[model samples]
Target chain A: MDITINRGDFVGLLGPSGSGKTTLIKTILGATDVYGGEVRVEGQSIAERRPRVGYVPQLETIDWNFPVTVEQVVTMGRVRRGWWYPWQRREDRLVAHEMMSRLGIADFAARHVRELSGGQKQRALLARALVSSPRLLLLDEPTSGVDIKTRDEIMHLLDELNHQDVTVIMTTHEINAVAAHLPWVVCLNGGIVDSGPPADVFTPDTLRRTYNADILVTEYMGMKLVAESPHFFGRNERGSADSSERGEHVHAASV
Target chain B: MFTPLQYEFFVRALIVATLVGGLCGLIGVYVVLRRMSYIGHGLSHAIFGGAVASYVLSVNFFLGASVWGFVSALLINLATRKRSISADAAIGIVTTSSFALGVALISRFRSFTRSFDAALFGNILGITQADVIAIAAVALLAAAALFVGYKYLLFTTFEPEVARFYGVPAGWTDAGFSLLLAAVIVVSLQVLGVTMIAAAIVIPPVVARLLTDEFARMLLLSVVIGALCGLGGLYMSFYLDISSGASVVLFSAAVFLIALSYTTLRSRLGSARWRRRSAASGKLEPFH
Candidate 1:
């Protein structure tokens, strides 16, 4: 997949499981072994870009009972290029404090990350990623395992971060809830199937190839919504909703 | 207690046992937290092989045993990380084989003398002033490394995968921890014995965990609990005519039981009070 993510681009990687979405992100981070093409950021090579990039791992992968306060978790990102130490330094603590305050988690700085609400947990991870003031941020399923309100809060935070010229790229399973709202989407299976604005790329042809399922694509009030037709056992015999339609379901969907 | 203090050997044993206890507890926090408690047990058993090898070659115990133990520690760590072998299988294979080597060497060379018996159980009564100094030195070195690598240790322990992105040298940290853990086990051999050392390393931290949720507090509490256990155990051994290592481990077990009971009872009482409040209000609501 030969694709370029410009400095200001806000892109969402959308695909089914085992779609190489995360591997691509790790390839960019230089964490995985590569046999072929190179990954470069700006004028620098792969190794140089990893320190400059911020990555938030999947929430499910985190050890929530780690016994660290939000402040400690935030300052973890302050161990940038050459610095490695036992505790957060004075300036690192200040930077962490500032970042926590900016994320509206200042009040919870001393609280353990385990005690955080779903939204606060996401924000804490965001604060940790942002503490280094990276020009680029990469998140893996930031909205997964969160409620709708929390997901919206996370997306709003990322949008705000992107607008500030942070250059956000994230891999998400949330298609309609997340990728459809983004300005750019990369549909991938084993490789990039297509890439464009959501409205341009979210056609039934492209989504089917990416997801290998009949995905219902609808637009409501200019927002692209992607969903799967409900499988009704008896209703399937009445008429396969997908069977009757080539592109009719796009218009057939109601508000 | 005061009469036992008058004996120089008793004083030396006391000092060495206390230092060893605190050091094990200090390092044990990482072992227990990382779910690598078996590493401590496995490494101690492996270090026994190193001990025999050192004695056979007439090498300095610390130098030869440390290098041997360090290599074994590294091997166990590497094997576990590869994940080709299950953690228990890896530990069991490596550690038991190494221990068997030591047993074979001991059985083969009958020249390897009295300390071998002490190594199995413990020989605190036979402790020397030099042993005390060695334990203190190892304790200091472990403490200094922990102090310097505090953040790295915490990050690696808490989040190994993510810590690397922020520039924490996770591999080096793991190697260093393995080396330190091996050294602690080796030095603790005389005071706590191979049989009891794992408990000394594991129990204090575990008891502390039940008492507090904070990491720093847990570390401090573990160390304190370990030191006090050491002191109390030694006194009990002297008064009750028991083995020092056995007394210390038993004391630690007692503390763990107390902590578990206290936390469990506190939570039960708290829930009962909350239930009373809900019944009075005639509605389900949050206790807080």
Candidate 2:
């Protein structure tokens, strides 16, 4: 997919389960090989822009039983020394503590990370990503297993960060989560099926093209939402909910 | 026990056991935590090939075994990283082939086979001052590497992709760790032998895992368990006239079993007590 993510833009990369969202993120981080196209950050290739990019991996990607404290995990973001030096400077510790407080996890700074809830885990990871003060932050499935309230809180946190000029590009399988909160949503299947403001690209036809399944798209309070159509479960009585029609039931509650 | 310590060889053996035990324990935490216990097993077996080759060629045992073990570790790592080969398959192939080659080579010469028993099962009782120094040197190097890279090592062990994303050089970290594991295995051969060196690299961390969820505490606990196991095993071997390597492994396994049983029993009792208290408060409910 050909795309450009500008600074301070909160773009959510939306896709189905088997889509290339993770592959794209890995490619951006230079952790995987990019077969065809070039991925540049601020006119530089991803490999060259490594220092300016921060990453918050999915919660499941970490071994929570690893026995590291919250503050220690956040302090790993500092890039001041090579791996040969394991010590964290006082300034780095201060920054990590400050980030922990900002994320509302200061109370658990010395607690084992496995003791955290899913929401707290995501916040801790976010704090780690922000501790280094990178120009661009990349998150993968930040709210996948979190509760609805926690999901909203994470989205709000991302919005607040974006407003403060830290460019963000997070990937998620939840389409309505992106459509409701993200100003820009990139629908990704094997490639970018569509990319624009939510209103421009969150249509039923666009979602079907991206997901390769019939999806219901509807409007609620001037906002677009997407969900799997009820026809998929052999209940063909209700066709795909297009934007113009309002169903009796709220088919896309995620919005 | 006091009289045995008066002998120089016994003294050297104790020093070797103490250092190698703590060293293996320190490195073993990563091995256990990363679930790379099989790699340690594979490399330990692979070291036999190098031991046999160096004996036949009249070279330094440590040099040959370290080279072979190091090469085998890197090869196993490479095979697992490939898309086709599974980790267990890679380990099975590399370790068995290397060990088989060592056996075949030794069987060709009766003179070589005569001295192979000590190398196979270990001869800690016959440890020399040179062996002590070499073990001490490798132990120090391993300690330095771990101390310098503790944070990066922990980060990469738990989350490689995240560490790579932050420019932690995860690939280099992994390669360095593998080399360190190889060196530790080689140093451990004289005390634990090729057959049981992997156990020394695995058991303590496992016991610590059962006891604590914190990494730092796990490291400290694993080191202590290893040192104690070594001292106790050596004493048992001295008194019983048995194999020190086997004794050490048995001691470690016994400790692991005790820890497992204790933790399980405590959790069960704790839960049952909670249930009784809740029942007394009339909060118990029936299942559907």
Candidate 3:
């Protein structure tokens, strides 16, 4: 649908699988055909400018067996006009090293991306995205599957980048862990259901419209937390859910 | 080696083999990384169909075969652009159909199959001065294209979907690469043979992969290894009176076995030492 993201906006897109979250991200990156309307940076045509969008894709989409080092992946961001020659210039290497150091992946520069831990691999991909220093950054499920500590680290890094005036937009399913803390979020299902501060946009009706299922929301320490309707989660601490009830829970969760 | 050089035919064969070796290795990096290994095998056979058609039409073999193969490859590229059909499926569909056409034509002109012996299994003895120049010309074209498009190639190979996000002209890259692949197959027909070309293209890159974790090193190593194997196989063929194509592939296979053994042992020893160090320091294993 129609949306406007201002400079330094730290926005999260929340939606279910196949709800066009990743497709919207691809549309922004010009990876998909723009049939009806145009995407612009400010008022200028994106085509007029050089291709410099920074994208951090989902880790699940990566091929870990591919032979690439941290250094190599980072320099991949600089695959633009200046790289007409085969080898990387001294400045390319310097920029890659600087980005890696900033991301705390310098120690793993020579290591294969395959050998890295989950968070470390995310950081490597982040370093590659940021090496070009674009004004905008788009991440697809950046914090997905990460432990709490690693997730916090990555969020803080994104926060730090946002404070420096880089517009950050990420699509994620971790509504509680990630989208809850975002300054703004869009609840999307093919089109924008609603968008505002998390407390305002993450309403039960909006979430149900987005996920096609009832969801539970609560506030803790002034932050809104979301969970699947506990009627479907599992047995409570006291084992209240019966065997048939647990089977129902599994089916509901699958849905 | 010195004795073979005295004969002009041997010298021509040696030069063409070396060039084809390097070219195949260079392209093999992309082929293997993209998991399009079968395209090399399939496209070479498809190009053979074009070669057969060229003979019947009284067209220049290189020109006709290259165009036909290029068109076939582009169809495959376009077919897989949406990724509805996997790379293997696209290659198989196009290659088999094209090959079937060749078979149909051959039945009509029975004499055509006689000439195809050189193409099917390679005839290093048939390499002429013109073949030498054609192979070298294609090699230069390939080197220039690779040189200019190195970053795009690496980015595309590493992440095909993301490469488009960064302004890589994916369609053009695929089409250009298809043309190069067609030319490579056409030029290599006299030396590597259609049936054996896939092995030449696969072995060098795979061996390089086993030896290194770095992409740049793998690229360089594959080229060097391919060229050396080409030279070595030619020497062996001269002495052993074996098919040069077979000799080259057998040499590459031997090298692959050595590399596989070395890497496997290194990884085992490396893990063992890592375990020992972790126990000594009472630290948990870092990698899961």
Per residue, candidate 3 scores C-alpha lDDT tens digits across A64-169 of 8899888888888887747566777778889999988988889988888898888999998898888878789999999987889999999999999999999999
RMSD of each: 6.8, 6.4, 5.2
Better of 1 and 2 by DockQ: 1
DockQ of each: 0.41, 0.37, 0.50
Give a tens-digit lDDT track for model 1, residues B51-139. Answer: 99899989998888889888987887778777488787888988999999999998999998857568977879877767777888889
Q: Give the TM-score of each candidate.
A: 0.91, 0.90, 0.89
Off by over 4 Å in 1: A47-50, A80-86, A232-255, B280-288
Model 2 chain A: weakest 10-residue lDDT segment is A228-237
Per-residue lDDT value at A225 in model 2 = 80
C-alpha lDDT (0 to 100) for residue B26 of candidate 1:
97
How many angstroms is residue A142 displaced in model 3 relative to the true structure, after the best TM-score fit? Answer: 1.0
In the range A1-255, model 1's lDDT, one tens digit per residue, is 699999888999999999999999888877887888778877677855555678898888888887678888888888752355566789888988888888789999888888888778888988999987889899988888889988987889889988899998899998888998999999999999999999899999999999898878888888878866776576447564555554445453211
DockQ score, prediction 1: 0.41
Clashing pairs in 3: none
**Candidate 2 residue A228 C-alpha distance from true site, Å:** 5.8
Give the alpha carbon lDDT tens digit for every residue of B208-269 in model 2: 88898778899999999998888878877888888989888888899989999999999999
The numbered model that scores best in DockQ is: 3
